[model samples]
Target: METTFVGRHVEIAQVARLMRESRLVTLTGLGGVGKSRLAHRVVEESVAEFPDGLWLVELACLTDPHLLPETVADVMGLADQPARRRAEVLAEWLGPRRSLLVLDTCEHLVEAVASLVDTLLRAAPRLRVLVTGRQPLGAPGEHVYSVPPLPVEDAVALLRERAGLAAPPDGSGGEGGAAELAELCQGLDRIPLAIELAAVQLRTLPPTVLLRRLNDRYHLLTGDGGPVRHGSLRAAMGWSHELCTPAERLLWARLSVFASGFDLEAAEYVCAGGPLPAGQVLEALTGLADKSLLQREEHPTGVRLRMLDTVREFGAEWLSRLGEDSAVRGRHRDHYLRLARRCATEWPGRQVEWYGRIRAERRNLRKVFELCLADPQWSRAGLDLAGTLWFLWVCCGMSREGRHHLETALRADPGPGPERLRALWVCAWVAALQGDLAAARERLDQCRAEDPEGSVTGHVLQVEGMLALLRRDHARAVELLEEAMAWHMAKGGVLSGLLPCHALAALGLLAAGRPAEAVETLSEGQALCEVHGEEWSRAQMEYVFAWAGHVEGEASGALRHARSALASALGFEDLSLSAACVEMIAWAVTEEGDAGGGAWLLGVAQAVRDSLGLPRSGSGIFAPVREQTLTQAVKVLGGAGFDTLFAEGQGSDLGIAVKYALGEKIS
Candidate 1:
């Protein structure tokens, strides 16, 4: 795949045409038949046709078919915060968008994939799915396109390009060479993978020698393979495996445990020791890459490696034979468990980097999450791990996904412990955020019942306060929030909750129409945040302060505080908080006498909420401002003028809008 793509123009065109006439297109072929590459090529050619953009979900990394929809949701950047099923969330979010979703490597999960595709298609009428596998998904209206092996000329060209040779020794730049190369491709069955595998052996063996070796291997495979095209690819793959050193072979088998491409540190830790030796993993990894059995990709963090699915399957078969599947999986799980804890520890300081790091490893983390939840022995670890990821799920707009894992863990282990107690509170927190008051209360009740001694006193109080505020019970909310803040002050707060308690209490105070007291509470919270060098909670407090100032009828002062909060929100990149700040600024703008500017900000806020599927702040504390601002703008500028300005805001890039709102020069 590192080399230039040599063929498949016809197939790409055919698939492109199929897409125009169909919603589901399945590219089916034999192993190593280039279906995945072909699917990507087709999407690239017609990408501009879809307005919602193209998303490629690599299904080979998934071990659990049940996660099919979650994987799709993750790829689409949909914040899975709603308490509904993941497929429902995906359907609602994608229903009105024109998008192309490519699900790659579906041979193992055809049934699940088909079921998901059926549901998604029924709900999201404008959505299109392109699938790649050895067989069809068989969903309604699915157009099946059989990806063929490279034809004669393209096969020779591919082999020659992959080998990087001017001419084969047997062909010497003439009709003789053309005949020789064609026959070589024919001997390898003209399959792209088979030809590529054969090309690598040309480094040490001449064309004639490699051809003879391939023919011998092909005939030997004929007994079991029975003249199928797969026999040719299998023969080449076996030869490639034989080319690898024993250590490299063993490393390949162990590396198969990684759900996705992994960095060198992961491979060294998971695939080391025993006969392979820890110190030699890198050397063996390099050997596999040199033989074209695995690929190396350069990333900003570091170099990561991955093998093709065919190669990974071959290694998996070897691993099954060696009976180290359980041991390797255990090592993989333990490594990620440690990494998850480290991510949680580092998130306080590296909020921005934390988001990037977790997203890069999300597929692997999901696999680990599923493994632990599925096994009773690992259920407790799952409970703790799910709770530990509260920041990722809540702050990152993935609250729905967070709830998914937590619900699974909570169901798997029902007992009395600090882990279960903390998980209950975290689940309730997200549930309330999504407007599921009943579920939120149920989880909170569970939390209290499980921990009779109240180990998570502050956590429970804060969520109760949040739920009350969302329900517009201002007096009760204020009282509960005060208790949470007092407990936080007494015990010295923990990450996200300690200082955030002040922000939650401040919001409750604002809801109760007490802006003056809210300021006093936020001042102390902001100072504590500054002391800890934390901006996430500090930004939240600033956002609450801006709203409080606005509620107290101080337009300019509230704009100042809101601007500062918006800058910080942009830095940390929380969609919901950023939208809240934008909405606050709109209120300040209208109060300061710029009705048109306020209208534009309203549009931007609406766009942000729609794009990320975020609900209103505190369930609707500022909800009245939206209508009031729009009415004022329409009265001052007329319906047509207001519409034009509002549309501009909707069309403008979010970063530019933020800069515009901050009074910075827009270039």
Candidate 2:
């Protein structure tokens, strides 16, 4: 999708012309000067010339320069080949393909990106590289374009567009409005970002009032003999910062602690303190947004506020100068810590909402985890946070990230404790998902040893049961799961472990070929989930119920449960669950005498799995069902017919696949 670009036609045309004339075009500008936006505009305009496609690799979040080549390869969908260097793999993949590669935010990793780009440009003659940064990549034959701030007229146009305000009525004697806007834009150096920030204030403040405040602040700061930094974006930002009330400034600085955007409640929880009272947080937040320090975004879940990187950096500097860095960070960690715990606690009944909330806070959660692991005193907190998000990571197909955070926390805080014990089991769950049985076993053993008789023992047992199932020890898995379920139920509270216990126990029964018992078990679990409004675990249980119904030769019953499972899975965007549901639906359709439909859905399921980089073995419990379904569909449809239907399914997108699974005919 193309991002909305305003007031960059001239720059776009120039950059596009430069791109066609040279294989390398670098857009250089100061922070927040719209270099990235210009590059994006140029790429969009010139994309038709490159039939191979255009790929954007964002380096803002990437800190390790060593992974530059791998990051590029991953973005290009080029998997690593055994014994082949990543750069070599990338070059070979790009060779013979005419493509445009955009390397964004390269100032921090300029050397590494420059070297990689140089190599690729030499190896792949048809490749074009467009880069955005504060400086040039310095590669040979690099055409550098210095992007400037918007012209006064264009800046005013952009301000009006972004602020949702129309230009003052042409001849209504509202010329004053135009003059004020021009002055505000000039005050902000005609920088697109700064002008937009100032313009948003039109929602809450009159343009005249905003202009007055800016002038007052500028006059106060630029006293006699001070060389005016009118063209400095930082100076404009600082002036805007100075106009904020003390509470607004404090909130702005504290809000910098977040790695991504956050909502009002998070701001209140993290930024409220001695000077900034919690009661005033809402007002202060609105004030900051009006001043353009915070960007207000409307999301499906709720409205969120974000600080631009440059604004956030300025806030960080102020925070450091205020000497409240450590304390504010502590509050930041505590807030996300509480957030993680709440998500875990509420996940049983509010699974969909919790999933969205947690996804939104992922960047902040990562920041908190880093803060916890980096400080000796906060390592335990970090471990606790990581342990709390086990379900999000494991069930949501983020096992790799989950494992990385868990291992890092465990290494930093290996001391024996309840937190450490919890971290171990969570780590075990993630490791098992990755098919690392040995690591799973070791972590489970460590967890068991640390909390043999505590509340966490039930969780430990559940992990062990899951590992047993993975190893195909049906009886042992059944025994462990039953024991864990009973223990949690006896404890009488709504234990988070209960849901997993139910899931694994049902899977164990199915594995043992006791389809009826498995169906009954999962049915009860599903009933309980409905009572609690827990969609995540219920989705998985429904899939199991579908599988059990298939085993019992009840095609209609299996199809019903599979459809229910798919609705929940797609709602949560859980790819693994969706894949499993698709497979079960395919089997049920085959049993219902639609061999072509079954083959098509099987192809869709395989596509979903491949998109996630999951191996066929990743669907451990459902592998037999998938295999049987494929064999039967082939037998009924014949090889040629099956291949054509399967290809049709493979070519379908998620929306089409879902429609087909739900019994809609695909044209």
Evaluate all candidate structures by whole-model CA lDDT and list the values in order.
Answer: 0.81, 0.78
lDDT string, candidate 1, 1-667, tens digits = 3667788888888999999999999999888888988888888788899976589999887877766776786667544446356676567656666888999999899999998898888998889999999889889999999998888888888887887767546555632377777888888778888888888886667777766787677676565543454778878887887888899889988988888889887888889979987899889988888888888887656677888888887788778779999999899998888888888888766777777767677778888988898799999999998998888777776776788888989999997788899899999998876678899999999888878787788889999988788777888888988888788778876565778778888888887778778889899888887777677788888888887877777889888988898888776557677777887788788888898898898888876666555563324655765666688788888999889888777656666898878878989
- Model 1 off-target regions past 4 Å? 64-67, 83-98, 115-127, 167-176, 215-229, 570-573, 592-594, 611-618, 639-667
Per TM-score, the best of the predicted structures is 1
Residue-level lDDT tens digits of model 2 in 285-305: 988877767778887779998
